[model samples]
Target: MSPARVMVVDDHPVVRDGVALLLRNEPALVVVGSAESGRAALERAAALRPDLVLLDLRLPDMLAPEVVSGLRAAVPAARVVVFTAHGDHHGVQAALDAGAHGALLKDAAVTDLVAALRRVLRGERVCDPRMVRDEDASRSAVARSGLTRREYEVLRLAAQGRTNPEIAETTGLARNTVKTYLQSALHKLGARNRVEAIGKASEAGLL
Candidate 1:
């Protein structure tokens, strides 16, 4: 069988280099390329056509979930393994929702990382069971938020740093209505302000 082609993506040079080194030691794996940013990773992914991608959860240019979503669309055949230092429920859920084939913590042992890659190659899902429980709780939390679907869209745009006028323009809602929706969303999310609402919503996987 041909060796599995892999691309390593992380902002930290040391982390990226370490992962590349580990993968290179495996005879069944080939380190095709490494990238330090989401943009660069997307470019390299298109060029290299790697069979697997080791993606970080945080990049300077994009969120890990956003990057995973983009890469999956950009390269449909590549298996994405999310590797990140963020072990919180929100982080894991975001990675999975973004279409990661596997989710692994950065603190995982080299053996575990290798196994995750192999399992994903074999078409198995790889993530902690805790992630499942977290997702369930998050779903319940979002349900209780009681926002309409359009309100959810508004909240997401706001989280993306859009102003009220911008959200109104994008959502085609009046500025006052947009403000009202945001305020209502904030209350339902139990947030005191825009930043907190964004944080809560993202944690609940509403973004």
Candidate 2:
């Protein structure tokens, strides 16, 4: 069987090149292409048709979820595995919800990265063990806080620096409704303002 054709998508030149070089050294994988941004990744995915994409969670042009969505739309057969330095549960969850096949931290061992990729190729969904622990802790905290899913969603958007109007547009809710949700979240979180609410929510992993 032929080696898996992989594409590395990252904004940092050193990281992108390094990952590609490492994957190239593996007999089971081949570096087919690399892109610096979400847009470029989509373009290259369309043209190169890589079997898997090693994607960064944060890119200059777009976030992980948006990029994952685009890649799925552009190449439905290609598997996406987020390779991010951040352990941000919200971002990772969003990308996974958008249909990414797996996620791994940049600090993971080279062997772990290769093994995760191979597992994904075999149709397994893998997430870093550390990330899974973090996610579980976050969910427990959120549960303890008793934040409703909508409230959590609104607060999460606020944490991302989105304005009320922007959150409304994204959630298909009226501005007034968004404000009401935010206020309720603030009250529950015992936060005096949006910034404080965001901080508190983040600490509690409600964001």
Candidate 3:
């Protein structure tokens, strides 16, 4: 059989290069194309029609979820696997909800990544087993702190190491508004800082 065609999308040059190098070494995997932005990935996907896409969550041009949706819309048969540094349940869930075929942390071992790619190509759902269980358990937990959608977005971005200014850029919210949402979310979650707020929100299933 021909090698499985794959495309990698990431803003960081090093990451894209490294993943390409790794995949090139795999006998059954082929690096058909690689892109530095979500928009570029979409355009390339249209031409290459790769079987799989390894997408990063942090892209300068578009949010990872948006990219996932666009890829799915453009290439219905291609499997998009999320490769992100944000291993939090919120990030993972967002990727899955956006129709990603698999979600893998950026820090995962190369061997694991190879395995995940193969599994996804075989039509298997790939995600952290523990995170899968956590999602189920979190559903049973009550969200005592009633935060609005914007507040949840702010909190989730904060957990991903984004500052107020960065969050504002990502969500198109004012910096002051992002700050206000963070403060309100932290208070409702009974958290002392962004980290604590993320922990609390994750526990409450608001994340």
Candidate 4:
């Protein structure tokens, strides 16, 4: 059987090279390409037609969902698996919802990473055990907070110090809509203000 053709997509040069080198040592996997951003990944995927894509959750120009959607659209046959440092439910859930086949943490052992990739190739949906546990634990918190996905998204941006206008622009929502979401988040979190809301959300693992 032919080795699985894999493409590594990460913005960090060292990580991209290191992952490629590691994969090259595996007899069943071949490192066919690498990209530093989501756009580059999409462009390369169209040409390389890799059997699998090892995608990072956060890129310089796009988030996991947009990148996953683009990659799937660019190469329908390629299986995409998210490799990220972030284990948060929102990010992982977004990637999965966008059609990622698996999610693995950056701190995972190389053997585990390789095994997960192989499982994905064999048609299994894999998520890191730690992430699963965290997700499970936080599920109730998320429900209790009554924080919708969009509300979490807006709050996350606010936590990053993005102003309402900036959040509106980034989310493509009207300024009034952005304010509404923030207000709703604050109310749901029982927060007195944006700062309080961010703090509460972070503590609840919503951010």
Q: What do the candidate models score in CA lDDT, each in turn? A: 0.79, 0.84, 0.79, 0.83
- Report the Cα lDDT for candidate 2: 0.84
Model 1 segments beyond 4 Å from truth?
Answer: 129-150, 153-207
Clashing pairs in 1: none
Clashing pairs in 4: none
lDDT of 4 by residue, 69-118 (tens): 78888899889999989776566765786689999998888799899999
Residue range 1-207, candidate 2, lDDT tens digits: 999989999999999889877776799999988999988998889998989999998787666666787889899999999998977656787678668999999988789889999999999999998775466777787789878888888887775556899889999999999999999999999999987876676556554
Give per-residue lDDT, candidate 1, residue 186.
89
Candidate 3: how many backbone clashes?
A: 0
Candidate 4: TM-score? 0.68
Question: Which segments of model 4 are wrong by more than 4 Å?
Answer: 133-207
Candidate 3 per-residue lDDT, tens place, 1-207, comes to 999999999988999888988877898899888999988998889899989999987677666666787889889999999888866645567667668888888888879889989999999989855455355444444344677778877876765456789899999989999999999988887889877786666556554
> Which residue pairs in candidate 2 have backbone atoms (N, alpha carbon, C) closer than 3 angstroms, thus clashing?
none
Q: What lDDT does model 4 reach? A: 0.83
Displacement of the residue 56 alpha carbon in candidate 4, Å:
0.8
- Count the clashes in each prediction: 0, 0, 0, 0
Q: What is the TM-score of each candidate against the true structure?
A: 0.70, 0.70, 0.66, 0.68
